[model samples]
Target: MIGDTPPEASPSPDASVSTGEKTGADVASAHKPSQPQSTESHAKHAGFWALALGSIGVVFGDIGTSPLYAFKEALHAAAGDGVTRPEILGVVSLALWAMILVVTVKYVGFIMRADNKGEGGVLSLMALAQQAIGKRTAVVFTLGIIGAALFYGDAVITPAMSVLSAVEGLRTIPALENSISNELVLMIAGVMLIGLFAFQSHGTAKVGLLFGPICAVWFASMAALGIGQFIANPQILASINPYYAVKFLSEHGMAGFIVLGAVFLTVTGAEALTADMGHFGRWPIQAAWLFFVLPCLTLNYLGQGALALTVLDASQAAGRPFEEMNWFFEMAPLALRLPLVLLAGMATVVASQAVITGAFSLTQQAIQLGLLPRLNVKRTSETQEGQIFVPQLNTMLLVGVLVVMVTFQTSSALAHAYGLAVTGTMVVTTMMAAIVMRQMWKWGWPRVLAFIVPFMILDLSFLSANMLRFFSGGWLPVLIGACLFTIMATWVRGSGILFEKSRRDSVLLTDLIDMLKARPPHRVPGTAIFLTSDSEVAPVALMHNLKHNKILHEKNIILTVDTRNIPRVHESERITIEKLDEDFKRVTVHYGFMESPNLPKAMGICRKQGLKFDIMATSFFLGRRSVVASATSGMPLWQDRLFIFLMRNATNPTEFFHIPPGRVVELGTQVSV
Candidate 1:
């Protein structure tokens, strides 16, 4: 359980090979510039259609498709075979309230406030937590990795359930239904799921363009349906009143809890809106949801309730409203039905794409933080650095989703496993948020409690409901996420211990140079660049270099390549060089998680800084250590093994750090871990 992906899982992306020490005031030479350059600039094009579709494609997948079966299952849970009309409306009303409170008020309105830079996932929040509770960073990192893993679970289940529910709608038309068996429906869904992931190998730039307009149409159609239903029965408007939600809660306490489990389905994908903030920017997503998506969704849910009241027999039709309610079909002509089906299918595919993108982003951050093994990631678009494609992740996710579609067969059965992962993510978010408020913001206890209490209540309600799904298949995802979390924590601890020991034995550059002056020159080297791990220290290789040669290079630069938590930083912020006089320089390079450290490009930038260096005159020195650890080495055996594996499997810095292959020299130092 060290690193999110095992070394065997995938190959490292571009930066996996960085190994050089930075020292002196000129450490700026070590910094690598982030690329596909445009991503560095703010997105200026007001792509309303892309924003609309992308938000819909990404945001609505889990919740948009919930209406297909949420009420049916909740009604069954509440009253079983003898369910009453009032009970159905009550649960439906609860579902509406949960969406308004959790998705609309909490996530869209509030939790979005806690974004870390442009990043908005649980890990980003954990970074905020680190700023808040410095010494207690471990706790926050643990929560983040767990929350991240659970999202993978959600990723697996959301597609299976969404597609199944839509295909299940085919059962409504008796003539059309006879041509499509349920098994056929499941198989078709499985194939579509596979195809959706397969298409991911090709970036979603074009597909993402199609997402907004289709989702806009889908939402508008749903709203139109709701308005029509409202025109028939205005009393259904009461559900929109917060009073009705409070009434449902006060009147039915224990029953309300079970209702909430189903109700959570309405807000399952709420996290996506914030998690994908980096790709779309905060404003576009906010504008799309508030101005377009939310109102339409509210109208549609209201219309469903209004339509329910007009029905004379609710239980006889059970969950299949299309079959029981003829007026709804009459409201839409036959020509529109096929287009609606196509739109729905496309919307689900977009939803899948969003989650897939989220998984990639999460994995990227994990690698940068040393929690995950490096993976071979390729930039899919020249214009968009953020748009990346990871083949291994795409394949694994596709297989997992299709397997669930095959296993569950029906969306309803899959629903039992859906909400738990989302709720778990929400729970961890709240925990990380509390830590952020207390530690980073320096908020008083009362203010922290005031902010966190409501979140805790909401998260606990959903998590408790999801707990009911444990025997129903909730445990599988939690187990997967737990395994991932364990690996991340293990690597973090291991890396910390190794960093500490490396620093302990490190020799100061000044001290080593003084000793070399006692002797004489042995080799021809004008400038030597050595890489160090901890940005503050000089690498031990400097001591050995001078001790063996009995001479100092005319110019010495200690370069430390630092990977920061944020996805991006200003260029002015990139190179912080400290000149340690006596012909020595220390350079610290700042890189965002989203960027790759192309060393040759960094060297070009270094040349631009007026640093005197000859490509032929310089020698790149790297401390290549074969790390070995025993019980006495201060790190646990598991962690030691984990770090060694991480080092062995990591890409060689000669390739990753962009050093001239022939000029680069590595000196081996055997160390007890």
Candidate 2:
């Protein structure tokens, strides 16, 4: 019997196939080059400087803005003992090394190498890792979902914290201090956030053109301010040494350990470098980090440290308190402070934009991979396929950002909740990278341990420090991650169960075709396309149509859309057609997890292959399942209910697959699971 397996299903290791007969394994093997040959050529075409500039704008926004609040919060957290020179050096050291170890070594050096068709993200890496292991393991799947969930939590907090911190600089300006109240700051930040999200539907292609130049100017400003402070006091450069970091830990002990949470913020956006690698390419991101973003951030942090040290010295000499000074804002001169505030505000807005777009891209990938319910995904660019906007996700993110802004009220307050999500994602990325090194890269155990152990220690230490603030505010992200993780896990589990249940009751395609030939029903004169998840079984909609309508179309097509692990499928390999009999044909359409499915466009391609498609004469049949939670279902009662809710809320197949509403027929059926 001829059978077409679903892309997500596990394939036999030794399955044999003839020239015409291709199994799921055969198709996957044909595409799995591990490292595509196009990676180098693609990187070359973009040019190094162009890519680096692009990376600075899109990839470094979150971390680049860390100079605004990270150091200030660290000092505030350690205010119990009062600010000292060694403490200042120690905090700066921690921040610098965190960037070096976390961003430079773990992500840019190693994790970025595990790209799937030059696409890098937690889910993309998950697909690559799973393929290497020869099957999907529960551990890898959970890690991917958890990483993705934590990313969403970070997404919610970043816009609120970044823009709020930047705009709060208004209060620091003596001229605007009395005019801008906390309420006013919130109003402005809220407006900026709303504007950002509102502009998402129109897409980022045009605005993105300006991000590079604007971010370049922002980073230059950061460096200039920092350099001015550094030139005034060269002693702060000593913090670059690891000795201060060690002395800090030795002197303060547990208190110093807790400060790591704030320091972790210095590298919060490091993950973006890898996640956005596909957009800018690896060399450009790496080059931008090493040559541009990293240097600017380091100098800024050093300058902030130098300024703090000078303030502490003055306070000690004059017998005053050190609580009044915020080195980040103090670094700017009185005359330029207002303009600096404006620049910082724009930079933060850029930071927020990157994360919001990332959330949209992640949602699209999750939905394509079947880990999420279908959402309305709209492409924003004609040339850049990755440019997309999900309206539902944008609205939810805006609401979440505003809620966090209102509740936290200040960037310092929001900082506590921020580290948990960022650190959690970093730790997960480290773990996934370890798996990739061992399974995909085929590194020796010793080599893997050497590379992964240090990163794990750093990530876990940061995560543990953030956990100390759980009661303070860290629990917000934990709560958010838990909820999102549950949703993703439930959807994946529910879909698997439903697929199995549906497949069990389905008639085999070979058998159905043979039966139809022997006892044919009344033949209708138009083409009919039945969309099915699995091509081996007859579509439920086809069965329902035959059962009730009592007629078979003159030409029937069983259509199955399979999402591959790669980022995209070439047009030549996009559609596979099999003839079971002259009256019936089984067609499988292939898409990548990063690509959207367009049934009409795919059908047009099919037309070139002798499969005729007439929009007016052809009808697309889809099965609309009304799912109910049953006590006997495999999932727990709560999860079953959640799955039912998600299923109901999911976008209709007609809209999701781009099938014309006028030419589509949906047959509804109740299914208990």
Candidate 3:
């Protein structure tokens, strides 16, 4: 697991297709001179409101479910021997203002404007920053990997936390409140979460239609319940003032700081607004938040505070100490508690879907950027390219979710770990965003600091607060993030060294072509498309064929695939061909990092370019390397073994590149790393 979308899902759209969709990056890109020009908006422009509505479900689900536990956990943490009214006000103030400053201002107002072409996400922004700097610097790469690594932690925890909190609501039902066992709650949550992951392979197109309406209703229900509580205790509205939040933190000492970690949960899913910017565009997510989602969430937290105060007054009148309670579920009138819990479960499920899909999108970007090994990617939807299922990622997420759920037991315990990963990612995002603004937007130091400092302060404050609870549970995400970072860093470094070594030992393509022309071998009839990472060098497979079989194809195409910094590559810019000789040609195919490559589709462009192409008549030659650890390798023994393990587990080139397996010829070579 890594981040929450529409709680943490990335709606990775195409980089090839340009549109005037008013995405976050579009506004920011205006300051940069070299950005791609925008064309007319999509045909779905008529459904502007509809897209906004759908974004509510997919983009804000994770955060929308926060009221289920955020306030309650804050109250629990703030309770020093006993619950107090000021603490209640402080908790509400923190929750509301955290959203306003962190989610509304930093993300929606400023950061969303920092997108890659029309795309937005940790990786998209990372790539955009690289484009800004004119090269991939160590700073941008480190931040990207760190942000992405923390996302997996968020991915694992989101489902566990959201589902657990929703199912935990069952204890508030009158009939079950007295009888429901903790084991039963855990079992129900475990089953539902496992089922959610299982259903992912089937794709969400049909069921996703219901997401908007369901989430819309969930928010409406929350708003209505909150309004009732508001009417009963309108005084709670004062908590929206930032002064109370400031006062609480300043006066309450370490207790308040500990509670701050709990309060950060309110904005845990804020990253989704930026992550899914590509999917729904800037205006829709912004519109959804500014008009609808923000108001509903603010009201709900207010209502929870109001309701908690009411319970407190009643308890004080009864001459008993005021006790912390599950104010979210209890806010429902006794008769509707069960229905509310059911809707909560539905909302949580929907949110979890976003988080999981975010994981898939993040992994896709990671692989495209060469930070990860190629996993088995299966497109679940024929019409929609973004709807993909990664089998390995899915299994990893499911296992991580289950393990987290079992270990945390309740959402309250799990809450400590959630904000750490989310905030760490937020800090990383802010740092990268600063670089993008400085370099891409050409912001001066004073301007960059002025614009980015406040957001950095907020992110770091929350991250530091979460760190206070390291032993309690905050260490989990940190541990997970560190491990992921190591893997990514190792993979990147090892792959770089391997590529350099391979290039050093490989024969030059021009030299090979010249030699072949001088002394031609037995000629074959059809085309031989030899795929390699570097087209400047002759492919190992081609060299093997010439050395062993002592033959050459009549038409040999040296094919190379390169991933672009953009989301998708347009057909016109998909390929380039150079006729090195009558018998040999160099073909280069370009794809956006967000795209899955299909060699056949790329070759289709070759036919239109006066090159004869036939899939049936062509033999695809791929180099298969069996890497063994070497004592003199660039990396240590452990890292060498780890990279080899990753390479061994990487998906087959034919499958990864979407080539026909039938016409593929694998030439194996032993390589030392």
For candidate 2, the per-residue lDDT at 435 reads: 85
TM-scores for candidates 1 onward, in order: 0.83, 0.93, 0.94
lDDT of 1 at 117: 66
Residue pairs clashing in model 2 are none
lDDT of 3 by residue, 261-345 (tens): 9999898888899888778888888989999999999889999999998988999999998877799988898899998999999
Count of clashes in candidate 3: 18
Give the poorly placed runs of model 2, Cα more than 4 Å off.
Answer: 1-46
CA error at residue 545 for candidate 3, angstroms: 0.8
**lDDT for each of the candidates?**
0.68, 0.84, 0.85
Worst 10 residues of 2 by lDDT: 12-21
State residue 244's C-alpha deviation in candidate 2, in Å.
0.5
- Model 2 lDDT per residue over 1-673, tens place: 0011125723222211111222233355467667565764464455657767888889988888999999888877777767777888898898888888888988878887777767888887777767667777889889889999999999999999999998988887887889999999999999999999999999999988888898999999889889999898889999999999989988887898789888888888888877897787777788888888889988999899888888888889999888556577889988988888888888998999999989998998888877888889999898998799999999999999999999999998899999999888888888887787787677899999998888888889999999999998999999999999999988888887778887887899889988988999999899999988878888888999999999999999998888876777789888999988889898988888789999899998999998986778999998887888988767998998998898878888888988899998988777777
Q: Put down candidate 1 lDDT per residue, 1-673, tens digits, no spaces.
A: 1122211111113212111212221243235355443532223233444555577756665566565566556654565334454554676677777877787787777677676666678766765566445433456667877888888888777777777776666655545758878788987787788788778778878877776676677778878877887788777776665665666567667776666677777788888877887666666677777787778777877777676666635435575432333232333446565555666677677666777888887777667666665565666788976687777678877888877777777777787788888999998887886776676566799998987898899789789977877888777677767766666666666666666677677756667555556664664558898877654556756666756655567888888776665666567567767787767788767676667666666766777887768878888888777778677766778777866786677667675566689988787777776
Alpha-carbon RMSD to native, per candidate: 8.1, 5.8, 5.6
